[model samples]
Each structure stands twice: as C-alpha cells, then as structure tokens.
Target: MNRLFNLVNQQDNRQLLMNTIRNGRVANAYLFHGPEGSGQEGFALEYAAMLNCQSRENQPCGQCPSCHKMKTLEHGNIHLVFPIRTGSLEKNDPPFKNFGPDDMEEIQNCIRKKAENPYEKLCPFDGKHIPINFIREIRRKIYLTAPEPGYKVVIVFDADLMMEPAANAFLKILEEPPDKTLLILTTSNIDAILPTIRSRCQRLHFPALSTTDLGNHLRENGIREDRINLVMRLSGGDVRQAIQLKEADLGRLREMTLEALRMIAIWKIDKVYDLVNRFVTLRKENPDEFDRLMLSISFWFRDAAILKAGKPESDLVHADMQIEIRKFVDYYTELDAFGAYSAVDNCIDLISRNVYINLALVNMFFKIHNRIQPGKSQ
Candidate 1:
C-alpha cells in the first residue's frame, strides 16, 4: 500500500496504523492532519485499502481484486469524499448530484491523477465546500449491509471545508460510527476542523519529510542531480512541491526573483508595474508559478543576509548566485537583509490570504527600500 507514494517520513504514523490492524483494535474513525504535501491524503487512501484488502496478512498485498480497485480508487466499498462546489441540494441526493457531464469528467480526471500520485495538487473548479447531501449518502450507505467482504471505508479530503450542516451531520456519523466501517478525514488545516469532531477521532499528525528523504524521492523521480539540493530546500519538506519546482525550472524562477529585486531597488514604477502584472496575473492562473517566484525571492534576501554576516556560500540556498548577491550586499552596505527577508515573507502570507494584491506587491518596494535606505524620501 505504501507503494502509492513515499511516506517513509511518517514511519510512526504507519506503525500506529499497522499496529491497529495487527492488534484487531481499529478505531471507528481517524484524522490524518498535516501541512500540504505531507502525504496525509495519500496515506488515508492506502489505509482504506489495507482495511479492505482480501489478504489475511493484515496488509494490502497489492494483488487482490480489492487491492486492484483500491489502487485506482475504484473500490465499491471505499467512498472517496471531498469538497466540491455543489451548491444547495437535497439531503440524500447521492454524491455529485449537481455535477454535469463536463464536471463529472473533470472530477474523474482529477481522481485519476490523485490515484497516480496522492500528493499531486489538484482542483477541478476551486471546490469551496462539502454539501450536506454527500453526508446523507455516507450515512445511508454505511448503515446498510456490506456490499463486499471488507470493511467499509469513507475518506474525506479537506474535511475542514464542510459547512455547518455537513459538519454536524458528519459529527453524528462519528458519534455512532458503524461496525466494520472506517471513516478517515485528512486535512491540511486541522485548526479549521471542529473540536467536537477532533475529540471523536484518533488524530495522527504527518510531519514534513526530511531533506534527506525528499532528496532521495526526487532522485527516484529523475530530478537533476545538481537541482536536488535546491529543490529539497525550496520545497520545505514537501515532495510534491519539490517536483513542481523541478518541472517549473527553478533556475528561471531564481532569475525572475533577481530581476525583480534589481528593478525594485531602482524604484522604476513603469517597469515595476509591468513585472508586477506578470507576477500577479500569472499567480491567479497558476498559483505554483507565483509560489515559486515568492519563495525564490525570499531565498535571494536570505542569501543576501547570509553574505552580510560574512557567512560562507555553503550556507546559502542559492549558493550559485553568490556573485550577484555579493555585489548587491556590497553596493547597499546599509541593507537590512533581515528586514528585507521579513518583508517578502509577509507579502507571501498576504497574497495567500487574498488580500489587496497590487498594493501589497507595490508596497514591498518601499518596505525593502526603507529597510536599506531608512529615513529617505521616496
């Protein structure tokens, strides 16, 4: 079952789950919570398979009929639930009642991608909430007799997105979870989950993968040897993000960051606005693009700060850009490199929250400059 992805970093979580299977003391429900790209969702799917596997060995042999279905997330007894934009619908209208043909097609595609790689970031149409109708269907299905010989498993991805009605409905299911039925919830934002729900389920925290583990995973994926270190650091211990950086050509993103800094330092409004448009506009269409850019920007300032402290290039994330950083630090002897890092870091958080984008980006100029050239009139 672990073959679906590299969850080696979550060894404790894996052992805990396996011990339950070994001890025949499975919980009625479980919550897999962690940061994005931490393999929470993927692990839920595999655990579901393990519970339903036809083998008597207490683990998925990856060869049974049930295992085959679980591999592609097509099992009859396994219910894969997630948030969707299915507005106002009946309480028992079945899953995806409001979805049209196109929507269904898109969802199937996203599911296939997820089945292939659970960490693959996907959004069919920016799903904002889980409908209560889906919850009713889950309640209905679990109370019925088993359609198959394995335990009924229902997995809800991003369970935090459930609205009030849906959340309450799910709480009831958790309160009296059916026998031979397991419901697993995976969420990146566990704080958003209702504490009532949290108290009922066994909570498992999935920590970020170590750089060494991420590096190994990237190597297996054929990421360039030279880019492995940079990708590992930039991914913040996320394997999916590491792949995204590798595919997006992280070197180009670094160049973009350096260019923006050069333009911002001179306070050229026309050119800066042009660059900002390129950044903000693309960010709306491709968030990973903007994420790469911003993370790269932060690294530039981090390198500058490291250089300012007279540290070795070995300590820099973008050590290859040492020459450019050295000159930048030398020219702006008063540059508050630490302040500059905080500025971009804060901007990243703002943009993620959907704050005023244009102003927020433009302000970075004054903010970074003020740090370097304090008390100077713009």
Candidate 2:
C-alpha cells in the first residue's frame, strides 16, 4: 500500500487531495478539522511529502529524499508548530512568562514522539496558550523561499490553542501568504479558531474512524482480543483513547463501576452517597483515574441498554459480564435503559464542564435509580 493511504482510512479524502495534486491546483491554506487521533497530522505530513516528492508518480514515493526527510520531520522546507509551555513546571501549575531550557527539552521530546507515532497525543502544557512570539517567528519563516525550490509547508498542530494575539497575527499571513507557501492548520476544536483565519482556509472535515478500523489498528499493535473489543466499544472510534485505555487499570475501574451500579440497583441511598463521596475524593487526588471511572460507568450503562434492546451479546462492551448486564436489563424497559444512558451521558458532560463531582455523580445515581424502578416513568 502507498505510505500516505496507509496512514488514514478516509479514501475519499485521499482521492480529493490526490486529484488536486495531479491537477496542480493545491490550495494555499487548508484546515484539517477532526477529532484527535483521526490521523490529521499524519495526513498533513504525507500531503506535504507528496507536494514536494521528486517522483514520477503523484503519490509520495517513500524512496524519494523528500519523503525520507518528511518521515523524520527534518525537511528544511517544512515547518512544524504546536502548543508549548513558556516555562518549566508541573502540568497543573500556573503558566509562566519565560521559556526555559526544561520547557524546550519537553517540547523537543513531544515532537520526537509525534515523529514516531502520529496518533500519539502531545504532552499538554495546561493553562498555557500558543504565544504571539511563535506566530511572529512563523511569519518570518514563511516569507523565506524554500531552500530546495519547491513548496514551503507550515503545519500548525492544535491551532485552536492560539491566543487572541497569536491568532490575529496569523491572520496577516493568511490574508497574503507568500507565493508557493502552503499553510495547514489542524484543530480538534474548530470553533476555538478565529473566523477570519477559518474563512481563509479550505476546510476538510474528518469523521471519526469506524470501529473496524480502530479494531484493526489495535490488533495490529498487538492488543489482546478481549482488550481490543472493550477498547473498541469504549473509544467511540477514537484510536488514541483506545490505546490509552488499554494501558489503564481497567479491572479496577470496572469493579468500581459495578459497585456503584449495585448500589443504585439495590436502592441503597446511603451506599450510593458513600460511593459518590469516594468518587469525589478520587477526583481530587487523581483526576485521570476519576475520568476512567466515569467512562467505565458510562460503558456499563451502554451495555445495559444493548441488553435491554435485545441486541446480540457480541455487541456489548462488557460482554464478559453478560450475566450481570442481563440481570440489570431485566429491571428496566428499553426506554428506561435509554434514559439511564442519557443520564450518564449528561453527567459525563457536566463533569467535563467542571461541575462539582459529588453533585454530578450523586445526581446521576438518583436519576439512574429512578429509571431502574418498576412502574416509574423516566
């Protein structure tokens, strides 16, 4: 298979870009908008290589010098930008003003990781923004002619992290980009980008990967069959997240989720409160673990809904716990099961938006409790 096509499953998108390349009508600026891990950056790199490849074929010939340079992200003509912190600090610490040596090392490490695995999420510099100074640097670099006399490609990963000043500064270049320069801005959250910048770029919307694609990728990466099935169901087509969850303490998370569900199912209000308090404590001490717990709970309800709908057991995310799921389903009508799922979904949303953890989980428990009771209409 061609190296570029192997990076993504969106054949139509590949064909569109190939046609543009063959026709010599490639756009000056493009916005590759999609969920993280959908291979936006990989596609951008392959597209860059294709644009500059000195091959008879239109696709990037892996044998070409340009293609080899692109593989390591060392092509002089291609520039890369992504979110970086200004100072050395723990991830939860407040942002600092000056870029330090440690910060530079961290940024380089992230870049190297991306070169190795395009689907990997970069280490986050929480509470930091892509500063205006980086935009100015990009502005200076974009105007310079490509050393090799081909296209000058600038790829901005996580473009939505740009602060107001940085975004505004970028608009100047977007308005009048240097000849033969291609700017590609990729973002998981397109609404965070400035309207002016968005209007200047040709938008390419990437959909989530299909379950089959995600499963294949996991299997190819040597994930166990059971783990692959669970991760596929929980990931909602997000391969990056599936990889993360595969490394997590999934058994513990499932046990916690089952305990919480048991409390709700048995109408033990006091025990439910205790469970919610435990979750609140976990949120304060280890937020990532708390998130995994919440995700596990959501998946549990999803399986219950599947069982209630008479779906195949093979379709359940918690297929190993089919007996437990079937028992849970017997307590509710299909509508009730759906209502429970929606309640859990709302709780997940609220938690994401920084709602009080105890309140959100406790309310979610009560909602599920109400839905599970016979003769109750949710």
Candidate 3:
C-alpha cells in the first residue's frame, strides 16, 4: 500500500475513509470541504487511487498497474474536472467546445501536474465557472460502463466554482451515480455550493495543519532553514501558501509591512503616502507580490491584536518582532487593535475582487491608521 497519504495530518479522516473502503461500503458521493491547502484534493486523489487499485488490499498497492496509472493520472476510470474560463473558447485559447484536442491536452496537463504534486493548486486560466458544457460531458461519461473491473472515480477540484447551470446539470448524476462509481467534490467554501448538492454527498471536513506539523513539513521539503520560520507564521497552516512563500520575495514585503505599521503608529502621513505609492507601483509590477504585501500587513495587525489581548507570545505569527508588537500594542485599545485587523481583512477582500490597487491601499492605510491612533476609542 502506498504510504504517501499517511504524511497528511488528518488521521481521523484517513481512518474513516480506509474503514469505509475496507468495509466495501464506499459512498456514491462525497464533499471534502475545508480551508484552502488543508489536504482536500490530496486526499481525494489518494482515495481514488485506493478505490481503483487492483490488489484489493486495505490500501492502494503502489506496485500494481492500476496504482501506477492512478499515480500519474493516466487511469481510464478516473476523471478529473476543474473550473476553466468559458470565454477561452471564443478566443480559441484552449476552447471548451466538444472538449476538442486542445482542451483535452490542457486537461491532461492539469491532471499530470496534480499527479506530480497533489498539494499544487489548480486554477482557471481566465474564467471563474466550471461551465455547463464540461459538466454535461462528465455526466455523459459517468453513465458509461467502466473500461476496467474497478470503481470509476470522478474528482472535482474547487467544485464550488460550478455555475448555476453547470451545478444544476450535475444534480442528476449526484443523485443517481452509476454502479461502481464514486464522485468526490472538493471546495474551500462550502457555502458557495448548492444545498441540494451538499445534501446528496457525505461531507468530510479538513482542518488547518498545526504549526509544528507545518514546520516539519517545510523542513522535510528542504525549504531553507532561515526562511522556514517566517513562512510558517505567514502560512496560517496553509501548505500551499507556505510553498509559494518559498519562492516569494517575502523580505521586501516584511520590510514594507513593518514600515507601514511604524508610520501609521507615529501618524507620519507623508511616509504613509509614500508607502502607499510604492505599494501601488508594486501592484502594477507584480500583483502577486502586492497581495503578499497586503497579507503581511494583515499579519502585522494580527500580531498587534494578539499582544493587546494579552495572549501568550507563542501565539504570535510574528514572534520574532515581539518587541515591536509589544510597543504597537500599547498604542491602541483592544477594540481598536481588532478593528485594525478587520480593516486589513476588508482590504484583502476588496483587492481579491479586483478593486483599484491605489484606492484600496490608501483607504486601508487610513483605516488602519485611525484604529492604531493612540487615543482612538473604536
């Protein structure tokens, strides 16, 4: 049996799934919902491989032909689906029409990437929805007889991105899946999924990894020792984000965050303005870095809030900046500290929705400044 999945921290979930498979009572449909990077998709792939493995062992034997194919996502019985830009069709950029040769190639590439690294996040190239056309094709394919003598597994990553039409088209299959078929849907936001779909599937919840687990995983992955601490704190236990941070220019972002906080606390309007301008420029140059900067600011406020609440120092994401956080905490009431945290969160939400970078940063700066002012009440 493959031991790859044992590395994941969700022991209860793993045990339950293994029990069901051993008992030969696998559910027709399952919803794996949790925060992003909490091992939903990884578990889905592992479970799929286990179901189709030919050895009939308690877990997937990595040596079997079925297991080999499943590992590389070449198994005929496994279908992987994810959201794609419906509009890409009009541009002839990996169009969705009839799932043409180009579309098939793109889908295969995506699956291969996932097979290589189950923790890798798959996102639409441009659009937001999993179009009805894709779901329709999946529904048709699911009704067909399995090509081999094992379970057919259809795994949908980010299933919450299904549009209304596509989601409606999927209900029938979810309600009456074919014999020897398993449909697994994964999503970071459960509320975004249809109630009917949620009701039809057995829900499994995944929790964020603990700090110790995350730290160990990073070290084992050969991540630099010096950067591990910062990434660990910034990841909030999300492995994907931690991986991204490995390649990210986090030092610059940390400097910006600290400077912004220092300027805000001192009420240095000119320095804040200059900082916001630099942020706008960074957003134009590399939007991802800009987002990371905003996340850093959020963490800064979070650390201040933790200090204000008289929480243990160990709880701080920026524990290395304990002195600064302590000083910052003295400048605001607990309510204002929390208010600053909320303001940063609001800014992140707006930025995610494609709000103008300069306006969002400027407004966020002012909001944070107000909350952190020495005499502010709320």
Candidate 4:
C-alpha cells in the first residue's frame, strides 16, 4: 500500500523508515514511542508492509499478493500481539475459547478496523491495559516458523498498556527472540512501560506534526479553510485527530462546552453536579471518549484564559472554541479564567496518574467554584 501518503505530515520519520527499509537493515525489535494520535501505529504497519511486500517500491506494493494479504491482515508472516481482557475468562470467549479460527477471525477483524480507522469508534476492548493471556498466545506464535522466506514480523500496538505479567512473560522472548523474528511495539505512554522491555528494543520517538504540515494534511483531506483552526486546535498537531475533527460537527462541541461553562460561571452547584452526572454517563458508555471530552473542556478553559489575558488565540490550544470563549469574557475575569484552567489541568494530571474519575470530576468542580472569586489564586 502507498501508506507513505497516510503519514500525513510525518515526512522526517517517513524518510527515516524508508532509508532503513532501503538498506534492509531493519531492527529485531523497535519501540515507537509518542503521544497518542500521532500515527505511530500506522507508521509501524506501513513499515511492516514495506518490509514484507514482494514487489518492493519506496512504499509497499498494495497490489502484490503479499501486500494484498497484509492489507487484509491475512499475511501469515505478519503477526500481532496485543492485550486481551479476561475479566471473567470462561471456555466461551471464542478466541478465549480455543484460540480457534473463529476467534482469530474476530481478532483480525478488530485489528483491521483499528488499523483502518484508529480515530473512529473505540474498539470493544479495554484501552487502559493489555491483558496477560495475549502475551502467552504471542509466545506460541513466535515459536511457529514463518510461512514465507523472509522475516516474521510481530507488531504490538499500545505496548505500554501491557500488564506486568505480560511484560515479564514477553521478556524471555525478547532476551532470545527467534532468528527470523522482527518485533515492533508502539506506545504513547513509554514511561509507563517496564524498563526491562524498553532495554530490549530500539527506541524511536515520534514527534508531533508541525502546524504547516497539519494544515496541509487537513486541506488534502478535504477540510474547509474556516474549520481548519478548529481541527488544528483540537488535534494538537496530530493528523489522525485532525481527520476526525474534519468529519465531526463543531456545533455539538460548542453546545457541550456552553452547557459546562454555564454551570461553572454561574456557580450552580446542583447544575454542576448534573453536568458531571452527564459526564459519568458518557464515561460509562465509552471511557475513552469521556477522556477526550475532558480534554476538550480543559483546552477550552485554557483558551478562555489566554483570550482573557489579551494574548494571541494561537497561544491557546483550543482556538476553535473562540465563539464559546467570547461568551465567558462577559461573565469571567482573567483571574476567574485562570482558576478554571488550573482546575482542569489538575484534573487531567490526576486522571493521567490513575486517580478515580468520579472523585476527580467532583474535586475539580469544587476547586473551580471556590477559586472563581476575583482575587483567588487556586
């Protein structure tokens, strides 16, 4: 496939990988580390395709037999290892059943969907941690020799989420990996992963896309000039996210922010509680999405503060929220805006550190409310 195009704005990284492929000096194990939505996983897949493609080009030949199989995720030599939850492992989870053909089909479908559309609907699995059982299965696959003549490649997406048990189990294979094996692990949270596992892999950090690159990709992807700033603000230089913002309705995002801001600005405690209750419900439906929503709110507050201070809109990460931000100016002082920003920042920090979401939400609300007074510093 011409996945080099899918790279969006990561020209430097793409060039680096292309050089490595051209030289046939691929690493035995690679750790692609960066912030989420930076297209690290897509890069890994493209690299894999380039390595495994029979009819080689600067990119993968999508029409070749090997490339066709890989595009469909049916390539025998291209394997995947990821976390699988067994919260209540029974003999009935299908793949969790016998690791059978049907189970493999389901897993392949899930991964293909993820590969094709990482920013679409969340996969129906846990995102916080990769389960241990998946590691054991990976071990089993590693022992099985490649069906093709070249190398057997295993790509583990979201490797940082691997539980301790899985990490330890995989350490054995990493220490003495198969002769023909090539392992690539991609993660946004590299610090959270085990150091032992880190030591076994060649690390590559993926940088965020540049503003010009982001703008170009957005334009290429059919985003309008008027909404480009909105996508840019929400994406934080991540092209995958920019693609998402391009497709979503900003009116709804505006509505959600207005509701939250109304509750905060007016010091309506009960209404705040109701608003948080809505968040709780949203999180229950999709925890990952709830995290994104919280991020959106945080950015809005940050932008509002910047706007209050008479700074450039570009200084704020959520420039797309300006219309809503104008609403806050009439009701909030610069100090009030800063307090809201601080509260949201603290909440984000706590949540990232694995704090309970319910308490985090409530605590942020009260803190923001108490700090709303003009002279307050919290």
Candidate 5:
C-alpha cells in the first residue's frame, strides 16, 4: 500500500483500485470524480504505481526501480497535467509550450515538492487553467512511444479546470489512446467536464473521509482537542483541508470571520468598503486562508440558526461564540440564518467564476443585509 493513501485515509479506494488491477479490468481512460480534499489524485498516483510496478505479484513493490521512480514522480512513462500559468504561450512550442526556461525550472521545483507532499499545490500563479499545449505534449509522447516498456499513465489533476479548446483537444486522445496507455482525469466538479468527454471514460467516485478518520488524523498531527472538534466540522471530512487548517493557524481565519460578521452587521458604507478591501488583499495574499474565512462564516451563521431554532448551545459548531451568536440572534428576531449562509455561499460561487471580487463581496453584503434587516441601507 502507498504511504500517501494511508495519510489520506483512503482504505476503501485502495481496495477498489487494487481489485481493478488484480482483475485486469483497468480502463483505458478513467474519471476520478470527488469533492476537494478527497483521495482522488493520491489514488490516481497509486494506481499508476501498481500498473507499472516491476514485480508481477505483490504489486507496487516500493523497492522496485519503477516504483522508486513513481515515488519521486520522475518516471518516464508518467505524464502529469494540471492547471499551469507561464509567462509565454508560444504557438509552436513543445513539451512546456509557452513556458520559458525559468518557468521550466520552477515547474521542476514544484514537481519536487509534489513528490515530497502529494497535496502540495502545483501552480503558484493565480487563475491558471489547463492549456491545449499540455494536452498536445502528452499526445505527442504517446504517439512517439518511449523506449521503456511501461504503461503510459497520464494523470490530469483538476481536469475540469481545462478550458473548452483544451478539453476538446483532450477528447481526441481520450476517445482513442494507444494500447499501453491509461489516462485518469481527476475533478472536484464533474459537471464542469464536457458531456462528450464524461461519456467516454469509466467514472469512479471518491467519497469524503469519515469524521472519525479526520479526527484521528488531526490528533496524530498534535493539534489540540478544542481545535480538532472545530476543524472536524469546518473541514467536513476533507483530509487536505484538515491538514491545511492545522498548519494555516486557522484561528486567525476564525477571528477574521467573526470580525467580518460584525462589519456586515453594522451595515455602514465605510465599514463595508474596508471589509471588502481587506478580503481582496487576503484573496491575493493567501487564497486558501481567504476561502476558509468564508467557509468559517457560513458555519457561524449555522450556529446562529441553531440558537434561533431554540437549540442548546451544545448544538452549535461555534460553541465558543455562543454569547455573540445569542446576541446576534436576539437582535434579528426575523433573521434567516440559512439565507445568510446562502448569501455567503453565493459570493464564494461568484469568486470561483472569476467574478470581480469587489462586486461579488459587495453584492453579498447587501443581500445578507436585506435578508435579515429588510430595506436596510448600507
């Protein structure tokens, strides 16, 4: 068993994939669909290792030469494609496409980090998407055929991030790949993938981790029990997010979430402007943290909802904020907590679609304001 699969607590997926390999039912192309932080990508790498392992029995002998290469992600047969941003995108470029020499170095470094930690994010640049050239490079290698005898395993992480042209170009390869090739497309949003492409691949779903597993992992990380309880709720069984939240000093994000609620509750022009600007900076400086900030607020409102529904404070995820939640609930006698949560969720959706941050946030502020304090001006 791969060590990373254990890290992600993907026992079921591990069994399923091992069975596929043993039964010789591996598909030419597979779609790994699951929520973010699930073990889709990790399992994809593990599957590649199993297929290319040198030993016939007791597959993926980590001691084998091919297995060692897969461990470092330097195997000649492995093709990894993810969202990438380069300084240039020259039409006639190959391998790296428009990427300059410096970009290639950075990419290698990123790969080294990925080899170290499977969950390390690949792209440093923002708003990157899978490019057509990357797809072409893989197709080129498949046709050229490397000298080595191994499965040509192509794993495209976040496949839904590919734009239409790239997706369309990819469909050609997906529709018809060489005999010894396997392509796995991993995505958190399957609906974003084109229907044509989806229809052609064998789909495998990765379910979120269980709360018990999440808590046990957090405990192993030496996180405090108090924080573990909160993370178990906020991370929603997302293994990567649980790890990130532990290292990210998620307390700061929670504090910011509380402060942002106070700002919105004020419903003043200057305060709202300052809040939005702060968020813009957070989004640019630390996108993951910013995302958690929004997620944190939704749960805060959920806690408020619990209080409004006459539930005890023990029912609140934000039990520490019981006093504040009680006061907020008391003040807004007609507050619709779910509606407020939806307003924030809508803002997350808008930002995800590359909507202007200022507009998305401002619209969210006003929407919540109107929902709770009807006709309230900001």
Candidate 6:
C-alpha cells in the first residue's frame, strides 16, 4: 500500500508536485481536474500521506506509524468526504446519514486493486457523489483544530457531484480554510461545480494516457493480444476505460455492427427496421450494458475507414477487428463511413442528456441508415 505518488507511471507529475511541497508553497485548496480514471484520487491520497508522514524525506516512508494509518484511510488528521445513500440517514434504512464507513471501504478496495494491477477496472464511482449532509459534516470537522502534528488533509473525490447548495455551502471554507488544513478536490465534471469554488482552488489537469502507453499497460495486464486493438481504439487513450473494455465480451456486438452496416449500405428498409428492433430488444434486456454496444459500433466504423484506405493492420484503430473491418470496407462507400461517425456523435449527445436509451439507439440507427440510402429517408 505504498502511496500512489510513488507509482512509476506517475513519476514526472510526482516530481512537479514534490517541488511545490519542498518550496513550502502548498495551497490551502487544490483541485485535481480531469476525466474519470486518470489517477487523480490516487495522486491526492499519496500527497496526503506524504504531508502527514512522520518521516517525510521526499515522500511518505510507507513504513512509519502515520503512513500505516493513512494507507488504511484511518489517519485522524486525514479526512474523506464523498457521497452516500440517503437511506443511511434513516434508522430503518441504513447506517450513517448520507455517508458511512462502507463508502470508505468501497473506495479503499478500488485503490488497493488499482495499486496491485495497474490495469484493474477503472470506474468513476468512488462511492457516489458528495451529498449536502456530507458537506455539513466536513465543515464541522475542518472548523476544529488539527488532530495530528501536521496538516489536516481532506480529500473530496467527485466534487462535481455536489449539488448547488452543497457547492455554495463549502465555498467559504475553500476561501479561508482553518490553519494547517488542506483541501484536495478531484473531479471529471469540473464545469458542474460552482465557479466560485473552482476559482478558489489551485487547479491541476491530468491528461489522458497515450495510446502506446495504454496498449503496453493492457499487454502487461494479460489482456488477449487479439482484442487489444479494439479496446485501445474504443478507450481513446483512457487506460482506465481500456481496462474495463478488456473485461467485456464484444463478439455479439461485432456481429451486430457488421450486419447493421451491410443493411444500411444496401438501402434495405425492412432489414434496417429488423436491426433496430433487435438492438432495442438487446438494450432493454441488458440496459446496464448498452454503452459497450454503442462503443463497439463506434469503433467498427473507425477500423473500417482505415481498412478502406489500405492501411496496415497495425495502423488500424481496432487492429483486432481487422477481418471485420475489412469485410465492411469491401462494401461501404465513403459516405457510409462519415454517416456512421455522425450517428455515433449524435447518440453520445443524446445519451449524455439522459434520453431514453432504446429511443436514442434506434434514432441513431435511422439516422445512419437514411444517410446511406437517401431514397429511404423518413
């Protein structure tokens, strides 16, 4: 359970942060801003451990008394604020209002697994978003004196989930935290958070991992070489997502995308209708898994385009789908390729808006089908 800052993959960013620690210019409030699964929370936890370690030379010794406690997230001076179920507040519902020890345990498990295997599944849920009651609890604790010899580090993960009231309620503390207090907020949805809160914290953005790095990470994680290309293309340089993709089964979705493309290219209205109906059924029966299907379809066209251009298998975004991509490219026109991309973008936009999943997927099918066959426009 060594600190995440000590991770070999993040040495460069760690060095930059260490320089700030050495200079004694630590800010009261810091924001780790980036997309999900970029290692922001791990970085924050490592820094907190370093800040509280009894024998901090350049980083946390990971062997000291303070380090041991911090590793388990039980350090008195280090606090965690995250979202919890409202049921936790009701005696008949659960324990701890809006947050409890279980929330902490879930996060701890994810962190531990991530540290053990860099390619472990990466997800944005660190036990839900920050609730208003959780904010109140944090305010009460931070308003008091430090519990240890060093700084009081309060790491708030997924800060963007804060409701408007909670965001405003915490603004005052961010502006003027108590002595020896440090606030580190991490989130992928920074825009949803209050501008006032954003302005108060020193922001650090974590970039997406490089494609080569993601591929190498996947290879090391024992992912099958055949599926690595599809995962990398669909992940778009997000290693966390790449790892998740590795855990999914995409054979059926691959078959669906190929047939859907073929139907659209031939201007077969009945076949297109059948495809959408089947997809809608698949989505309804497996609502939680629709996103993977969408991603598979999206990557199919990406690989097809590369195949059409006579690109080598290694040059394809979905190298693993070379055979499938070549099959589509053999019959698909340039117009068909562009149409598929637009459909995917439209589906993403609609999904983000919380639209009905079945309707959105069907609409995307119609849009792509019509683009390929003007005569079948509805």
RMSD of model 6 against the true structure: 5.3
Provide the lDDT at 306 for model 6: 62
Tens digits of per-residue lDDT, candidate 4, 118-215, equal 43322335445666666677777778877876668888877877778778877887988898788899888898878988988988888876778778
TM-scores of the candidates in the order shown: 0.85, 0.82, 0.77, 0.74, 0.75, 0.76
Q: Output the better candidate (3/6) by lDDT.
A: 3
Please give the lDDT score for candidate 3. 0.78
For residue 156, model 6's alpha carbon misses the true position, in angstroms, by 0.9
Query: In candidate 3, how many clashes are counted?
Result: 0
Q: What lDDT score goes with residue 197 in model 3? A: 97
Best lDDT among the predictions, by candidate number: 1
Tens digits of per-residue lDDT, candidate 5, 169-276, equal: 899998778988999999989999999999999999988877777778789877666567678776777776677775357667667877888788778899999999
Task: Tell me the spans in candidate 3 whose CA falls farther than 4 Å from its real position.
Answer: 4-7, 88-95, 98-106, 224-229, 258-272, 283-288, 298-316, 319-378
Two-way lDDT contest, 3 vs 4, winner: 3
Better candidate number, 1 or 6, judged by lDDT:
1
Clash pairs detected, candidate 5: none
Candidate 4, pairs of clashing residues: 94-97
How much lDDT does candidate 5 score? 0.80
Tens-digit per-residue lDDT, 1-378, candidate 6: 245332325556677677778899888998987766566777788888888877747468878888877766668898776654443343232224344477657756765664454334323253354556667777788778777788899887778877676687789788678988999998878888788898899988876666666667788877888777777766666666666654445566566566766665665667766766776777669753566667777777666666666766776655656776665565344446666777887897887798986678667877775554332323
lDDT of 1 by residue, 1-378 (tens): 345334546777877888899889999989999988888988898788778877877477788898888888888898877878776665557768778999999999988988888887555688888878879888888899888888999999889998888899999999988889999999999999999999999999998877777878888889876567668777777777777665557767767877888777877778888877888897889877788778777888888899989887777777667788888888787889999899999998887798898888988767986776523333
**Cand. 6 TM to true fold:** 0.76
Candidate 1 Cα outliers beyond 4 Å, as residue runs? 1-5, 121-123, 265-269, 276-288, 326-336, 346-363, 366-378
What ranges in model 2 sit over 4 Å off?
4-6, 86-97, 227-229, 262-273, 285-288, 308-310, 323-343, 349-355, 366-378
Candidate 2 C-alpha lDDT tens digits along 1-378: 367334648777877888888998999999999887787877888788889888868568888888878777778898887776654444334332365678767766777767777776665555357767777777887787678857899998889989887799889998899999999998889999999999999999888888888888888877767666777756667766677775446677768778887788777667878888888899889887787677777777787877777788777777667787776676554337778888988998998898987888888988988777754343
Winner on lDDT (3 vs 5): 5
Alpha-carbon lDDT, every model: 0.82, 0.78, 0.78, 0.71, 0.80, 0.69
Q: Give the TM-score of candidate 4.
A: 0.74
